[model samples]
Target: MTEALLDEAGLVRWGRSLGEVAAREAVFVALSGPLGAGKTRLTQAACAGAGVSEAVTSPTYTLVHWYTGGRGPVAHADLYRIRDASELPGLGWEELETRPGAVFVEWAERAGDELPPDRWEIRFEFAAGGALRRVRVCVRGCAPPIPDPAVYSAAPEAPSC
Candidate 1:
């Protein structure tokens, strides 16, 4: 599905809807975008929607960060600094997938074939002079269904951390 994010709140609402669907089972989300494209913000909102209270920030330096206040553990990974997929093992990529929770990867293209086949791919692009953004979301292999936009539009009633 593709959607327009008019503001940060809209992006958060969309992420929340996605988080709701992800809470049902282990899932992988690959985020692709240029610098300052709101990837971390979306992940933060998703974690919040999943009931995680801990602060969610980009794992650009640490590579991976885990949150557990939600239905289950939520793993966030940033591969911007990764030089090769071979470094994934050293970062415990396999173990993260085996956990019962959702995984969100930033700069996922860098992961290459290391990423699971069943994953949700989200691509973001600047629009309207960076005042808005266009998000394209798609699923690969056997992934969970994405929630309808209506679910996100009704942001007032969205689940909270």
Candidate 2:
């Protein structure tokens, strides 16, 4: 699925939509984008949609943050600082996938093959004026049904797929 995000609010709305579908067991979400592409912002919103009340911030320095207040456990990881996929093992990458909840990975490309095969990949790119963004979501293996667009008034442009 591909959509156009008019602004940060629209990105958050779309993240919430993804959160609804991600409330399932053992879900993996891979976010790939350049700096300032809104990955962390979307992650925070998705956590909120999943019922998390605590503040969500980028784990860029710490590497990972776990939120259990949501409908289920959510492991948010930032691999931007990691130099190689070999570092994932020490970060509890295995445990995150087997724990029975959702996992969101930012700068996922850095993980290489350490990521699970079944995952949702979201790639973000700057739009014309840099004020907007284009997001593409692709599912690998099995995935839950995407939420209905009618649920969000600020939702992004309809999914291309």
Candidate 3:
């Protein structure tokens, strides 16, 4: 596991770097955080890094959204509205798991034990008086390593989270 304190721009760069590497192979990323923690923003940056030309929006209500990028396919799902893990299958959870390229799920803890064992988990916490985010990344099974946002130099300020 690794952790870093990142401003909004740093968070985006870190997410983009993660996407660049993850795009090389199929991977599942689970994002867990409270509201306004920047889960969707990170996903958008990652999709951009993967060469997704279209806008990447949160599937909070839609549940799931799919797009084809230069690297391959990208699937973004939000489980915020899900009341139980048992409800996932109705949303095509099985099919989403088998998707190629990268799959990102927000409010992923809502899935409980139903999530794949081999995956990456990222958690975000408000920090520095909510001016920054404390991000933690961990791997399960044979999941690939994640980039350390601390390695990136300070980036210009971005819109507040």
Candidate 4:
């Protein structure tokens, strides 16, 4: 998938949409964007859509935030303060390769050659007022296994007509 730009609300909507797409294919998202791009907001919206009910925030000091509710241990990482991007593998980066939940990384560009080839690359930027995010959800190499729809289903069915 190529890059597509969107407004702030559109970015949030895109997050929700990406969650839906990953609902069937465990998604490991890497949020790549500058400051004030609404990366955390987008992540929050996506997680909420996927069943998370807690407050999502940046892990600047902590480095990583694991949210468990509906997505089942969704992890969010901010590499902005990372000293050596090559140290990712040692930080359990391999987990995202085969998980159902997403591992959103802000400032993923710092990872350089460390990032896998299949994870989603979400790039966010500042627009006129709010923000604009361009997303490229690609799952070709790492192939993070897709989770069954029933796992993230909200309402379930009312019986087929």
Candidate 5:
């Protein structure tokens, strides 16, 4: 489940595909990337791919945003301001695992080990040459092997109706 997507369009295509696969697990997705590297863009695309009808926005200032009613609820969180894992539980981190919907966390590196194990680890890479970006998707703990970020494959089955 690893490869290399080229530009914005490629990233969106891959995001949509990944979103479809992610819908099956119904778990959380942690996005790791620097500012302005397209984390929110990919998230929005993924939500759309998951049939999210409402707007998908960055929860920077608010810390979290909730979207429900499409397939199910989607809890989007940006933990950039969080300094320690202790603070997460207060923001519903503990409930994330038990919640009926999926979750998407931005600046997940900040989550540290607090990040749930059974989830997608997505890292965005912006090459030195241009505005084009690359996204790498890997399961947690399977990290070291994914040396560089890659454009992984979708699990094949179409999204659930």
Candidate 6:
């Protein structure tokens, strides 16, 4: 498990680091957190690190967004509107599972047991009077290693997703 207290900027840095690693191979990431906890922001940063040039936006209404990055394809999905796991298939969850690049699923708790066993689980929470974020990441089953958020360092330019 990895944990960190990150300002919004730090969160972007950490997310990019993880994306850089995930871009090398396929990985499923499950994100769970309250609204405004930066789940979508992290997904955007990860997409950027994977070399996705187009805009990365929360697929709240559409449910899923697909993009091609330098390494491979990237899939970003949101399950907040879903009340149960059974609805995932309607959104082509199976296809997203087999994607060859990084997959980021926001509001993943809604998927319940339908989520893949081998994946990364990330949880976010507001901390320090909502001025910072507390993020926790853990691997499930035999999932590949994830980058350590503690070691992240921000670049000169401000991060935006």
Superior by TM-score: candidate 1 or candidate 5: 1
- Tens-digit per-residue lDDT, 1-161, candidate 3: 87788888888988888777666666789999999999999999989888889999889888889878788778899999997798888786777776676888999999999888989899999988887988888989888877776665343347699
Which residue pairs does candidate 5 place in steric collision? 3-151
Worst window of 10 by summed lDDT in candidate 3: 150-159
Candidate 4 Cα lDDT to native: 0.63
Tens digits of per-residue lDDT for model 1 on 1-161? 64544467788888887776776567899999999898898899889877889888888888889888457678899988887798888786786677778998999998898889998999888877886667778889999876654434322454677
Question: Which residue segments of model 1 deviate by more than 4 Å?
Answer: 1-5, 149-161
Q: TM-score per candidate, in order?
A: 0.87, 0.86, 0.91, 0.70, 0.79, 0.91
Superposed Cα deviation of residue 24, candidate 4 (Å): 4.7
Q: How displaced is residue 35 in candidate 1, in Å?
A: 0.8
Name the weakest run of 10 consecutive residues (lDDT summed) in model 2: 147-156
Worst window of 10 by summed lDDT in candidate 4 = 146-155
Candidate 5 lDDT, tens digit per residue, 42-134?
778777766788888788887778776355567788888888677787776777777766678899888788887777787777764655765
Cα-based lDDT for every prediction: 0.80, 0.77, 0.85, 0.63, 0.70, 0.85
Q: Which ten residues in a row have the lowest lDDT in candidate 1?
A: 149-158
* Residue pairs whose backbone atoms clash in candidate 1: none
RMSD, each candidate, Å? 5.5, 3.7, 4.9, 7.8, 7.1, 5.4
Pairs of residues at least 3 apart in sequence or in different chains that clash in candidate 2: none
lDDT of 5: 0.70
In terms of lDDT, the best-performing candidate is: 6
- The residue pairs that clash in candidate 6, if any, are none
Scored against the true structure, residue 138 in model 5 reaches a CA lDDT of 79
Score residue 120 of candidate 3 by CA lDDT.
88
TM-score result, candidate 3:
0.91
Candidate 4 C-alpha lDDT tens digits along 1-161: 54455665666666675655554455667777667777788777777766777888778876777777464557777877776677676565566555556667778777777776777666555544543444444445765543232322323356898
lDDT of 3 at 64: 89
Judge candidate 5 at residue 149 and give its lDDT. Answer: 31
